[model samples]
Target: MRTTPRRLLAAMAALTTALLASACGGGDDGGGRAASGELTMMVPLFGTAPDPKGEVHQAVEKVVGKKLKITWVPNAEYGDKTNVVLASDDIPQVMVVQGKTAAFVQAAQAGAFWELTDKLDRYPNLKAKSEQAELNASINGKVFGIYRVRPLLRSAVLYRKDWLDRLGLKVPETVDELYEVAKAFTEKDPDGNGEKDTYGLIIPKWPTPVFCSASPYNVIETWFGAPNCYGDRGGRLVPAFDTEEFYTANRWLKKMVDEGLVNPDFATLDSGKWNDPFVQGKGGIIIDVNVRATQLYGLLKEQDPDGYGDKLAMGGNLKRSDGQKFSYPFDGYNGFLAVSKQSVRTEAELDEVLKALDRLATKEGQTLLANGIEGRNFKLENGYDVPIDDDDPAVKTINNDVDFAFVQLGTWATIGMGVYESMPTSEAERENLRLRKELAELDLQTAVHNPALPIVSPTYVSRGATLDPIVSDARVKYLAGEITEEQLRAEVKRWYDSGGAQVVAEITDLRAELGAGGN
Candidate 1:
């Protein structure tokens, strides 16, 4: 999902303060060294936790010169569990904290975490990354965590080239053309199945905040000239839904639903099930992360060995009706790492932890963490680190399954962009990466950045989480024809009366303070 400072803050505020300060504090004095070179950590697991006894884990421990203890919380429950841990003051020495969370802001304000602003300069690798990302991660203009670098834009339209070729259709270049393509894909039997079972497009039930890569709403909204999250209106910052363009986009999507070009149950469809139709050859298009093109290709080929799965292609950003192209811009960092004073206690221990993290940013550290033991998981072949075997137990043990353990400290995009470049063994894989990189670069040129990104709104911290669902649900209902346009407008008005107005005011004030102009 596309996470924002406001959303993270809201999730953080859900815990009770009594629970946060109840745990026993760390035993270290405010020194720069830990008595024992042992570090404890807690991070959200994107998949199953890696075996601690695995070669990758052992390799990381050897590089950092410390014995490690880590708790891998599932992503779905991470926010709540993190709250419980923070409330108990029982956080690990190193913990993953959403830099924009309210709990973290409150903790930082209360001196519960170290101020890394001045300390970051000492670590060359950490300081050399994006200064803007560090700014985005700051609270009250002070840095308290180390940001994990991510791409600024990764969204695009992925379609079935084989189907398009069979139908004698070219890649759509405009909003109207996209609609026509979807219509044809749905009714023209592009799959040659001799049945009307395919859909033109696949849409999620609720698509906003542009968080998930699969959310087509954001890309579709761009076509109607809507801004990302918040838009500029005559020097005032306003919620995107407050604009006429957003309403137009909603009506456009509703037309798709009414015409049966999109999945009928999309309003209530689970996100996990969103990709099933496309992968099973029942859908023709999807708007998602460019990397999914590679993944979808693999799945398609596996499901139909001789089918046209090999003809999937990535499409460029389509031009809006106004003749301009735009894509949503992301805050340029993933979740950041913060050291808890309740765990580390002393400045020395914090420094010790920081040093290890700094090492992880180096070439030696990144290579080891990304590829694992060179000879074990991969080997130098013609100047490239090639995978030994896709099915090898050792290879699987040291690959990305364990990357979550050590790669988060400071992975630069420059280092990661070459990941697909160096490892893709097939021409198809190479083409996917090449197309992804090309689209990302193009998106960069037309990205509409969120002006409220660094601005913190108290209204949002208190009511945003609640109001977000109200707006999202309303939009979904309106698109599904469950609600009228007038009712949709009323809901938007209700949102403003509730707290959206305050959010806009805070963002507008912050924009003025930062010397930024609107409209």
Candidate 2:
């Protein structure tokens, strides 16, 4: 795939082990003469981002009893940059990669990383959580990386509940009813603006014709009670793409296109473009990713203030007409952080960083993860983080400085499926939280959204070269009707013929070997 995280920073200093020892190994770490040094971190942030510092960094320093100097070399073009780093004997202390699965495996085989499996006990937090989760974000049955945990909720249909109520329409749970509601949204102007300028629904654009990459087919596919991309049946791995239910979904989409119910350019609409119709008050029914919904709600309030502020109501994953919910989670996220072989000169120091991560995973850590500091970042208003009270000075500091708050800590990643409230506000946004929780429950209730699918790491390594074009070509042709169902099958078969099948087969074998064949 086209590697990201590489086009981050090119201006990095190369250091020898001697420099690292002098800089980080000999210093007052966490009160004792602990290791005090600087190490380069291949952070997700590019743009000359300094190494970890301040309270968050300090907390980590405390955990490890060492001072860590961080240099961020963004994930924008991460995979290829990492490849470059790997070939050279000199590299950063650490690299948190996005899609480096194959690269990691290849690197491990070449003795490119510090195998931390036996050493994990040194840090109890990492050990417990990793063990707790059966932490398998590794290669060859050995723990090769530290996985960051976040919510696993995805694939649910959201509708304007208030609109349905206003029109005396029951929230649809069947294919026929869903179409009817979408049609009414177009014909009825569910927003009650007294104008029929609104369409009923929207489906975000899917990339097509070149590579049949998975896109937002769940909204339609789920309505048919079938998984669009992947799902589970009897705890066995399955592709809903092969089912007649999928055909029903496609047929429904075709009809929607013919009737102008869903946005015509849905195949091209991403979060940005997809939500435009919703924000402009031009759509009633819209299908969205979980995180995008929160963003859309915020934008609507900002754009119109009065229009969509409280007007928008979100919901949990909708049940398919067949009582099944489409699970959209993709093998969980591949945010495992790995230590480079070049950085192993100071494994003890690196262990400290892992310790800090372990702490952040706890309740106290979760508190800081949610609210920065007690009085500075946020204050507890009825057991909720409220920054709008102005009692904290760090609110602005965090707002400006803390970009990693969402990812490093758990809050951002877990913000959906229920926590979409007014953080640091007087009253929790119950409606927001409720909608998210409802959706979360829907995901949890569904047997599909697999939490343990040994999904290949989304690294921008080798697979993309072969995988991308096929997905692009397939997606485009299928949506454009240039390819019939037979064509789609032939294309999928080509994935097998051209090694995608082999890839899947390999993954299947690996999962089985791991005793995780339960997919």
Candidate 3:
């Protein structure tokens, strides 16, 4: 169940290696067409594959008017399995591929998967998805798959509002003010336990500059004027660590560590356990994904059914000392869905599969996929579908089945909020939903787009898996005061010597090739 970030990273690396080792092959020869009204698919499963005879499966088949044969691959092994399937010419008619990976790009370029650009316009719901997501999934400026859309940016500072009120402190509005708030939460005993045990902030272990919902490094760097990953410098693209802003951000984090304002074990802390201190009332603030607020609120209520439910709050887009506020935007996709030419074998079969997927993009399809059978899993109330017998074994089984059945297809933010509003029986969940929506909207106003997101460099494709850890280790060392600014710069030089410079040059050429300018 993705027990740890380190393990997950290791698994992904293994999968990438397996996929890269697989031999490239020709596209499907249009030989195995499913009988009329039947389709086969392979999708990643978060848990065990659900029973095909389950009510959720029946509901989906009834809605889409098709009989289905699906292969449920565990998410950790999906990439490797997909690679083996493609190499053996045993791929499903439809499959989910990690679009950003080098293996998928290689396979796509080799004509292993069908390109969907021309077919997209024929499906209204599929075409309605975010264009930027489609762009993010593109290979050499060509769209090859239908992207699964998610929020573009949703990072925020989640704090204990009740504690803030008791301490007579206001929500932080700037970087400096945020530090001050953290200091106060540490020394003021805001929890009123009359002990010096509470921390103002909980900094979780972050392995990279990638925006992790549970980590503060990315948000802090953005506030300090560092770019998401690459920044525009004199009309050329450069890594954020090469700039002075990255140094300043590292210095600020070091100061926080020296002051004991953040968790001391942050460099080694497990991200899954990041919320433990907050839930136990030993910390007051966390920089995390918007959805975590709801999860945290639920856990807090379960721990203290009568109290502490309404204490949590979320805030975001805090201004910097320079009067700028920005949040890094994401690629806005879960992954992507691709069709295998070998499996479908004909344009007519592809169209039938596309039509079925198009149905999944509709409101009815979304509702079914997200909530399961209405009367069985939920009931209508005041225009909302309140869950029914959520803890029942049958209901739980069906709900789990939905995750493996199909893709969410389109914007899940709105549909998710609706589900949240309908299911949470207490005010805390509702408040979490409200705060999530608020922060999401606030982030939209000042989201910073990464110019390098859609451009894949050959150097990065070959050396990134090795170099990223080096950079991350150096950053953590710098923030922990184990390395000086000069030493950090030395590490960056080593990075360049070890292929980062080549990556930069390739990305620059790619940007020019695509006519994308440095912002």
Candidate 4:
């Protein structure tokens, strides 16, 4: 019954494969001629896919000196598709691997990707990447890809400035002050609606583990003097959850939940809807990246052009009882652009692809990636590029289209490529950007790093999926009062018995080999 469709699909697939081989200029030794024809790339799409004929695409093609053939996979299906692609021999020439996952590591080790550690030094822009970002992107000290730069530190407390102003409360500087402010926001009707319908904090079901920098719990734990993910405890790396500060922070959060200051459905709330409650006046706090404050303010301005004036604000990490501050730091990269050996097939082909990427990292290329074709998407005024309003559908379609495919191909944040040319269109946007910069600087002064992030563990790589859930599940249970402190400790012990100890031992050895200080 299925033979007709199956045969037809198989014939179509073969035709596509043959076409790609012809266009890619199949297998020739590195010589006078560089790799010819269109370069193929696979990248995840956040929203609508960019048009191949768009001005942005054409500009990028001109800069890179190659016609690009890109496959736009949706974000939700990327992980599964990446796994399948890694297992096959038909990978794209350039692929955006989202993380250094077990499959990616194994594939890289097996020669599926070109080893790029020593090779990067040949390209000035690639070599100029931040040391930490490169380290975090490596697999057991070997680099197989060029990392996409993200901030080393970006987390902050995003809160309702208007609520704090109305309640006569200052931005919280200490843990105790944060708690009291939360209580006030919950008890007092800061919205002036004469109804106690709003809570203090809006915690969603966080997507990552509790130890990740993105987790609000990790933010509070680090502020309470716990390590970032893993800490040097007694000359050995240990999970942050094992520390007393972690429990203290959790107990404080639990108290907030018990007091009804936090959302009751936080454990099950969708992260996609995290900002909805804040926008709807049902919550007053969200601990996230600094840019979220600007985004929330922008949303509020759009909703109530006259009423919502400076409704959101951001601040650095809180000080502890002893007046010591600690800040959670990002992993310093989003993902990497890996050149596949299968599609490239030769040194010359690899060089051609890397050269295109090198051009993409330059100031001119970075400017194009970030702002798009200047006169079309933005206009220069007062020595800054002010983005034109994208209200026009035609303008919006062509704006930032190339970025969807190649934005992650540059080391912009880490190497500081291009000019800081963007000027906010509004006074409110300007104020928000200024405030974010100030708070981010404060956070950087007390950044706490995870010593284990760069070090690879065989046990963790093989059993991390199993090992991580043991701690994360217990943590969620502990927070919800489903388990007591004693039970939580038991779960931690269980984790140690289940490959965590091996992971710790490996990390300790690796750190020692690298001569990294325990602190």
User: Which candidate comes out best when scored by TM-score?
Assistant: 3
For candidate 3, the per-residue lDDT at 338 reads 84
Q: Is candidate 3 or candidate 4 better by TM-score?
A: 3
Q: Which candidate should be chosen as best, given lDDT against the real structure?
A: 4
Ten contiguous residues with the weakest lDDT in model 3: 1-10
Q: Please estimate how well model 4 matches the true structure, expressed as its whole-model Cα lDDT.
A: 0.75
lDDT of 3 by residue, 402-469 (tens): 54444333335234543323656677766666777777787777876667776777667666656666
Please provide, for model 4 over 1-519, each residue's C-alpha lDDT reduced to its tens digit, 9 standing for 90 to 100.
000001112133343444344334434432223377577888887667778887777787888888888888988888777766765546788888888765666567666678898898998877835777687777766788888787778888878888999999888898898898889889999989999988898888876553343578878889999888888998988888889998898899889988989988888899999999899888998988877765687689888887666687677788998898888878777788898776777787788888988987887887777667687877878766666777877678766463454454555632122345467656766777777778777788788877777677766766665677677778778888899989998999999998888878898898888777644
Cα-based lDDT at residue 254, candidate 4:
87
**CA lDDT, candidate 3, residue 504:** 83
Which digits, one per residue and each the tens of the lDDT, describe model 2 over residues 1-519? Answer: 111122222222221233333333333332121133444455555233423555655654454344555545455565566656655555555566554345455555455566777776776555535342334354535666666554545544556655777888875655577789888887876878888776777766553321212355644565566653444456444445545777677777767766878776666667557667776667766655555556666766677555454445554455556565545443344466666554554666666556655664555555544445566655666666556545444455453333343234341223332122345221224555556657666666553433223345232233445654564556456766677768877766676576655544554445556665342
Q: Candidate 2: minimum summed lDDT over ten consecutive residues — where?
A: 1-10
Residue 286, candidate 3: how far off, in angstroms?
Answer: 0.7
TM-score of each: 0.88, 0.77, 0.90, 0.88
Which scores higher on TM-score, 2 or 3?
3
lDDT of each: 0.71, 0.53, 0.71, 0.75
Q: Model 1, residue 307: what's the lDDT?
A: 61
lDDT against true structure, model 2: 0.53
lDDT string for model 1 (1-519, tens) is 124434345444444354245323444432223447776788777665778887777877787778778788877787777766766646677778755666656666666667788898898767837665666566645677787777777877888788898899998877888899999999999989799988888876653432222257766776577877777888888877788988898888889889999988887777777668888877888877776776776677778667634668777777877678877656787777787777676667777888887876677666776555677867777656677786986677666554554454435632344332356646766777777878888878887766666666766766766677667778778888889999999988888888878878887887778775443
Better of 1 and 2 by TM-score: 1
Q: Give the TM-score of candidate 2.
A: 0.77
